[model samples]
Target: MSPGDEHDYRGKDQGGRPDDPYSTLGGTRQTRTRLPDGDAGLPHARRPVRNSRSLVTITGVVVLLIAAIAFANRGGGSDEDAAAPGAEKPGTTGSAPTAATGTKPVQGKNGTIASGFAHDEQGAQSAAANYAVALGSAEMFMKESRHQILDTVYSPAAANKLRAPQDLAYSAEFLARLGLDSDGNAPQGSTFISRTVPVGTKVLAFDDDTAKVAVWYTGLIGMSGQDSTKPVSTTWKTWTAQLSWLGGDWKVTEASEADGPAPVPGDVAASRSDAISKAVEEYGGFTYAR
Candidate 1:
């Protein structure tokens, strides 16, 4: 953690962070932990109780949505240092943006995803942030692209283990529920938007060859079409990745998610679907660096 960045460090199991609703790995986790009351500034910050129907479909899609780049949920461990190196006390009040750094984001790519990080603390953080973006991206909804992401950012064993279950989880029925096709595309004249904006990254722990990093993020999901039932909405989450230096890069071996440290929503009136669609099309993402 850098000087003056303390406000942004969401180190290990903070008191107001999620409890159980966010323990997903491989998109099968149905229970999501929202922020405890102490941090609920927004009217709808806390999620309502999960129903069987919700658990069956929405849960699967959410983790996939994170994978699809609608992105993350990672909780720090109970110990302050366990979740992030140089982390703040669990009871700390709010979050701030990560400070800018001199280091440039890694420019290499494995297919479309970024790759080839330096083997160090910043490298692990960069890996976690980038992987969170990929897993949480909208493309994770599509089969081939999803597979490619799994193989790219995760350890081979972890990717292999997660694939079958995730494929089952993101079923044809699941896509239909979110207004997406089997190919994970939006209907004609509609745009399915799922994007994760990584807010900051903190290294919880690290060594010569392994590290754990946490990524705080805000994401946008839902369809950008006037007729869409699920209109584009935003969410806040923390995703922690247990990573290792494997195959010459940082690869995720395990992951978990938790909700909020979210801010109060602004009073801005919602924009039209066409406007939202155009913005999404015009905006480009960045290569996140720690």
Candidate 2:
């Protein structure tokens, strides 16, 4: 039970079909989520309706992988063993990738998400990591929170640009398949979890006005309930965000994701759906910073 070992972040994309690398974040399987009638302008996935169930239900088989993401970046262990917190395992490598710099995570909040980052490489990476969390979160599946996510993470122009498409991606039809209501609420007695946790960040490209940051992350997504057909699962992804120093903070201009450089799965047996559901309620998420 490491810091976030039971609460990884699973994913889904706003654009593209289930076959698209970025599209299927819950797992590798393809779900044909058809575009609603008269929405031909949308990039809706079309697969024959099967057994009167939603297609995205068959999308991916998630693996549960909870690893510390934001806490690893807060950096307070300036002790002698500072360089190797991950050495708890027999052959584990030093935690340089998740190494913290004693830098405090941003305290500023933008509607439950961190904001007000510094205008530097560190700030850019922090923003990207936190933004990735917001994008892949359960909130992102809900209309209101999804709007807030875009507005908080992206620039006005970028948010506006992505709004309609994002809404389409999480439409009622899609939610119905995932066993959620039109408002993204899970069925009674069930808990729906969609979260993203960044394991590390990299500055792929940077400039005075803009920066490109890549966040290596894992996500947990699915319904945790006794009768849940879609049990909680995991996905590994690299979310690359293009940020601009706008409004005195790093804002996202664009973002895209790619499938993993995922590690081999460990031998831990999967948790019961009830355990996952309870964990979702008990474990609070974090504000990622670097």
Candidate 3:
């Protein structure tokens, strides 16, 4: 699937399709006790003549050993001390770098979608993934919302080039094919669902002003309702975008997509349309970060 591919069921009408309606898814404790000697003749010997000095030395060594072991295991500091200012925390020498950068994900937004990402690799990946979500959302089915998203997510030149074709792709005929009205509304009593869940993102290339990122995602698109013919279904895809630092934000210059690194199907039973509708309504979406 490409960025603007019409194969996306969100914008595909279902009226004429005779094939399968919903297809193409991509402790232990120890104790010791001492016994007294029974000898009476050699009281000193039988009473176990205590070597006080040796006993004290042994006890001191044992205590020091325990303290040393504890300090080494704790990396020489408490958790609070490790977090204190000027403290040198443990290094991630052999460990994998986390997806998180511990920096604020986005500094601003264009409409509802995140924008103003930092001009770094992580920020570019974040921007691309978030842009994928916005472009694949149900909102993109409507003309007004689609325009808003294109303008917000794409660079000015790309937005201008994409507007007409994208508009055509989400036309009345296309919407009807997806069981949506001309205004991108589902029929009364039906819930239209189109959402993108980004599995992860990768930076293919990045520099100060340009970046290429790929977002692997799974998308849900279909209508859910008692009478709905198109049941909610899923598709896996990878959206790759070329982005440029423009207007103090990362914006899409172009985008393409591929099939997926889809996993095997699970054994879970499909939910009823009404249940799907209810879940979609009850659960809100998220603003994804890298």
Candidate 4:
């Protein structure tokens, strides 16, 4: 297969849903996963409850509390509850407006543009992949553009914490170390490649209002050229993002990276800078799958 067609990163099979996107990396998807709940390699099963009576009593109390809270919070028809000029119905704020309500295909949006992504698992994974690509790109190496991206990609709290450190990480000294100019621009003759080729995506959790997608991928980093210090090295990372399908597109509520969970390298031999440069130019990127 051509490099561009090497993988299906779109997270869908030919018919979609039941069948996942075919992985170019090959074989069945049996990689061990450590989820947020800390249960790794276990089939999705609830642990057996030990104490029946105590559990029932505790559950009844919790249910009663929840019911009481709901009753307390419930209100008579208030001004805010009444849908205003063009606002959505009450209790449905920030929900994806185009969620599949019938046989009708769902519409997607990015900002105000028509994106056409269904508000589903497939759509969330697609958004997460694209967002990760944007966040980890070479554009983040630039100041003004980096700020814009940071503000766009992260939640307000995360953006606040990320701004200073990110600025420091992509500073002139760091750029020089990575064989780039002061502005994070590579030498004219060399191509600066910073791309995350997603291996596969999994929705660790999904809901109507939010989704947490685990994007496991290998990325290419480093500058190209004879004297280039950080020669395009391969690394694997799992990027987890809490996504909200707001204002059309999935916006990252939070994001963080974890080391590896890398796969074994391919038997294909590593090429030199010239070959890599040529290959990069000749071979365009594709969506990856596991």
- lDDT string for model 4 (210-255, tens) is 8898888788888878877778888899999998877565667887
Residue 116 C-alpha lDDT in model 2: 82
Between 1 and 4, whose TM-score is larger? 1
Model 1 CA deviation exceeding 4 Å by range: 1-97
- Pick out the ten consecutive residues of candidate 2 with the lowest summed lDDT: 58-67
Ranking of predictions according to TM-score? 3, 2, 1, 4
Superposed by TM-score, candidate 3 places the C-alpha of residue 101 at a distance from the truth, in angstroms, of 2.4
Error of 3 at 89 (Å): 13
The TM-score of predicted model 4 comes to: 0.57
Q: Per-residue CA lDDT of candidate 2, range 56-121, in tens?
A: 443333322222434355345543444455444211234355655434557599888898886777
Q: What do the candidate models score in CA lDDT, each in turn?
A: 0.79, 0.77, 0.76, 0.65
How many residue-pair clashes does candidate 1 contain?
25
Listed per candidate, the RMSD to the true structure in angstroms reads 26.0, 29.6, 21.1, 24.1
Where does candidate 3 clash, by residue pair?
A: 12-177, 12-178, 13-177, 13-178, 14-177
Candidate 2 Cα errors over 4 Å, as ranges: 1-97
| TM-score attained by model 2 | 0.66
TM-score of each: 0.66, 0.66, 0.68, 0.57
Tens-digit per-residue lDDT, 189-238, candidate 3: 99999999999887777778998989999999999988877889999999
